[model samples]
Each structure stands twice: as C-alpha cells, then as structure tokens.
Target: MAVIPVAIAGAPYEVRIEAGLLARAGEHCRPFLRKNRVAIVTDENVAAEWQAPVTASFDAVGIASDWLILPPGESTKGWEQLARVVDWLLALEVERKDNIVALGGGVIGDLTGFAASMVKRGCGFIQIPTTLLAQVDSSVGGKTAINTPAGKNLVGAFHQPSLVLADPLALDTLPLRDTRAGYAEVVKYGLIDDAPFFEWCEANGAKLLAGDSAARETAIAKSVAAKARIVAADEKETAGIRALLNLGHTFGHALEAETGFSDRLLHGEGVALGMVLAARFSARQGLMSGQDAGRIVAHMEAVGLPSSLKALGLDCSGRRLSDHMLHDKKMDAGTLPFLLLRGIGETFLAKDVDLNEVAAFLDEELRG
Candidate 1:
C-alpha cells in the first residue's frame, strides 16, 4: 500500500492506494465513523459489481451500509441528483462529524462530496473511487461539483474527503476504453511538469493498461503525489499553480459540451484529444515545435485515444464548439486562460488567448 498526503490547509488528508483496498474498506473507514451505520452513495453500474463485497466488509465489523444507488452517467451529476443525495443524507441523520462513503466513479464522488459539503452546512465523506479517472484525478482533490445547463462543474464547491481508498483492482472491472480514457489524466501529470515521467509513460503506459499491477501502482502514486503538491500550494486556485492541472481541460470541456456530455465522448477521451489539440495549437502559435506536437499525437494514437478533430465527426462549426467555451469557469475579463505547451512537459497558462483565434485554429483542424 502507498499513501499520499494532500496537505490542504486545515483539511489535511491521505490517499491510500493498493490493489485490494476495496475489500478491506471497513477496516480503514472504521476510525472515521461515529456510528455503526454509514451511508454509501454509488451508481447502478458500480453497485451491481461491488455492493456485495463492500457491504460484506462493513458487515464484518458490525457496521451497516445503507446505499443510495443512482443511475450512472455524466447526467447524474446535476441539480436533480444533487438534491436527491442531500435529502438521502439528511434522512440518514448524518451529522457534520459523521463520514459518508462515496463508492463509485467520479459521478458518485462528486455528487456525494457536494452533498456532504452542504449537509448541515458540512459533513465528512470517504472516497472509494471505482474508476481509473476518479482514482487518479477526481477523488483526491477537494473540488466537487455538478454540471449545470451553462457548463460542467459550474455549480460546485471545494469539499475535501476525509480519506481516499483507490484500489487499482477496481479498474479490473472497468472497460478497456474507460481505462484508457482515465490514463489520459495520468499522462497529464507528466505533460504538465515531469519530463522524466512523460518519458516513463511513453515506455510503460501500454504495460499499465495491459494490467501490470506494479505499473498501475507506480502511475497512480506518482500522479497523486503530483496533484497533492499542487493542491497544497494552491487549494483554491487563487494562485496560478493549480491552474496548470487544467492542462487539457478547457478544450476537453468544450468538446464534452459539444458531444452533450454523453458516452459519445468520455471525459478522459475528450482530455486526450484536448491535449493533442493543445499541443498542435501551441505549435501553430509558434510556442512549441511541430516535432514535439507530433510526439504527443503519436503517443495518444498509440494508446488508442482520439488525437484528431476531424475524426470526432462533429457536424458543428469550430465557432459552434468555441462558443461552448464561453461559459467556462476559467474565463476572466472576456478571455479564457489556455494551457499551452512550449514543448513536451513544458506547459504554461496563456492568459491572453483569443477565442476567435482558437475558433480559426479549430476550423483549420476541422477542415483537415
């Protein structure tokens, strides 16, 4: 087991990574609970696979697990389900000191955490992220939100979890496509600042995706540690440090919105494509060399992630897609901050990016 500490001021926590941590969840969570009963929030898909093992683990410790299984998908992370989760927790009489468990992918974690943040003003929650994307990205961070009609994660809060249990074995149940999508976020940490890690990914990403246990553990630990340092330094993103984490997010979110945030494009898949677009766009702006951008494209394509705009088969214009970005949370003074690469592992936030230029670039890509 590997433990990564997120030193958020006044809310320090640990992310515990292991292969079979999910089956022993009760042992880890017993310390945080004030009662023998706990509330667990998950989606139907995860509940179908894991509800039995997790409940049996809790039952062994004389704890009762009360579950509220939501319908799975990005749509679940909205105002309606948020209200339902909050009402369920309130009905369970969960107090601020009580810790609820979020036992699925990002959707469950985000919704439950947002619910916890507002329940009686605030309560604690544990994250047992069942998907690769959640384990590597969403679970550890205090950022929690539901998507609104305006934008993704537009309505949310910074509510940190008490403890996070990320079991790589959980990914064993995930579809290969989903796993590869989550791998995009793993690659993001390297692209943001760690050149060596990026090289390691180039060499071993296939192994990790092929179910190499050690490689999975190493990747998850390194990714979590990178995020831990960033979150600790700039928890609220008031400082520009945490903004680096949004490397492919702006473009990715716009793509997601264009796809209507459905299974047609997974969040990680969009990010993989977004990172490629960021690289190509950086090359276009003379910020990075075409050779370096080609390397990103090659790596993404090697891993079976989407690497081109034309391949997405979107019927909309580049201006239509860029229009979706106008509502992005990163917008400031009518300009959106873009994460662009100077080279591999050399990412910087460009504050003066013109959406018109971005639209024109997208038009070029779409035409290609």
Candidate 2:
C-alpha cells in the first residue's frame, strides 16, 4: 500500500492506494468512524459490483453499514439527489463528527461530500472512489461540488474527505472506455508541472490501461502525491498555485457543457481534448511551439482519447460554447481565467483572456 498525505492547514488526510483496498475498506476507514454504524452512499451501478465485499469488510470489523444507492449518471449530481442524500443522513441522525462513506466515482464523491458539508453543520466523509477519474483527481483535492443549471460543479464546497481509499483493482471492473477517459486526468499531472512524469506516462500509459497492477498503483500514488503537494500549498485555490491543476479543465468544461455532460462526452474525454486545444491555443498565441502542441495531440490520438473539436459533431457555434464558460465556477469579476500552457509541464493562469477571442479560436477548431 502507498500512503499519500494531504496536509491542508486544518484538515489533513491520507489517500491509501493498493490492490484490494475495497475489500479492506472498513479497516482503513476504522480510524475515522466514531460509531459502530456508518452511512454509505453509492450509485446503483457501483452497488451491484462492490456492495457485498465492502459491506462484509465493515461487518468483519464489527461495524454495521447502511447504504443509500442512488441512480448512476452525471444527471444525479443536482439539487434532487443532494436533497435526497442529506435527508437520508439526517434521518440516520449523523452528527458532525461521524464519518460517512462515498463510494463510486466523482459523482458519488461530489454529491456525498456536499451532503456531508451540510449535515449537522458539516460531517466527515470518506471517498472510496471506484473510477480512474475520481481516484486520480476528484477524490483527493478537497474540492467537492454538484452541478447546477448554471454549470458543472458550480455549487459545492471545499470540504475534504476524512480519508480516501483507492484500489487499482477497482479499475479492473471499470469499462475500458471509462478507463481511457480517466487516463486524461492522469496525463494532467504530467502536463501541470511534471514533464518527467509526462514522459513516464508517455512510455507506460498503455501498459497501465492494459491492467498492469503495478503501473496503475504507481500512477495513482504519484498523481495523489502531486495533488497533495499542491493542495497543501493552496488548500482553497485562494493562491494561484492550485489553479495549475486546472490545466485542461477550462476548455474541457466548455466542451462538457456543449455535450450536455452526458455519456456522449465523459469529463476526462473533454479534458483530454481540452488539453490538446490548450496546447494548440498556446502555440497559436506564440507561448509554445506548434511542435509541442502537436505532440500533445499525437499522444491523445495514440491513446484513443478525443483530441479534436470538429469530430464531436456538435451543432453549435464557438460563441455558444464560450457562452457556456460564462457560467464556469472559475469566472471572477466578469473575466474567466484560462489555463494555458507555456509548454508541457508549464501551465499558468492567464487572467486577461478575451472570451470573444476564445470564441473565435474555438470557431477555427470547430471548422477543423
């Protein structure tokens, strides 16, 4: 097992990565729970595969489990589901000190963490992220949120999980397409500030996705560690340091919004394509060489992830997509900061971005 600690100012936690961590979740989560009974919230799809073993694990440690299995999808991350989770926890009489468990992917973690943020003025929650996307990025950052009519993750909190248990074995159960999408996020850490890690990914990403356990564990540990260092320095994104983690997210969110946040475009898929665009956009602005940008595109295409905008076949103008970004959570003071690359592993927030120019550039991308 690899232990990565997130040292936030007031809420430090550890992310434990290993094989079969799901089967031993109760043991790892034991230290955080305050009672014999724990509340677990998972999506119906995850419940079908992991419910029995996780439940048995808790039972082995003399802890009783109560589960609230919700429908599976990005649509579930909204007001209705949030209300349902909170009411169920309230009915269970969860206190601020008691820890609840969020099992499954980003959707479950975001929804359950937001619900925990409200229960009894803020209860603790554990993230047992089952998907590669959640394991590598969403589960570690302490940034939990739900989507509103306005945009993705527009409404949420900075409530960190009490603990995160990531099992690479979990990925074995994930669909290959989902696994490939999740690889986008793993590639992000390399793009943010670790060129060598990016190189490592370039060499080993295929093997990792091919069910190499060692490769999966190593990648997860490294990604978690990179995020831990950044989160420790900028726990709430108040400083510009943590914003680097959004390397592909700005354009990616716009793509996701255009796709209706559906299976048509997974978050990681949008991000993969977004990073390609960011690289190309950076090159277009003379911040990086076109060769470097093309390298990003080559990598994405090689991995079978989306790397082009025109291929999505959306029926909207670039202005329409950029308009979606207006509702982005990163918007501030009527300006939206973009995560542009100076080069691979060299991302900086450009606060003076012109959305109109963005629209026009996106128009060019759409035409291609």
> lDDT scores for all predictions?
0.94, 0.92
What is candidate 2's lDDT per residue for 233-308, written digit by digit as tens? Answer: 9998989999989888888998888888899999999999989989998899999889889888988988899988
Candidate 2 displacement at residue 305 in angstroms: 0.5
Question: Which stretch of 10 consecutive residues in model 2 shows the poorest summed lDDT?
Answer: 141-150
**Candidate 1 lDDT tens digits, 231-327:** 9999999898999999999989999999999999999999999999999999999999999899899999999999999999989888998999999
Clashing pairs in 1: none
Clashes of 1: 0
Report each candidate's C-alpha RMSD, comma-separated, in the order given.
0.7, 0.8
TM-score of 1: 0.99
Regions more than 4 Å wrong, model 1 = none
Off by over 4 Å in 2: none
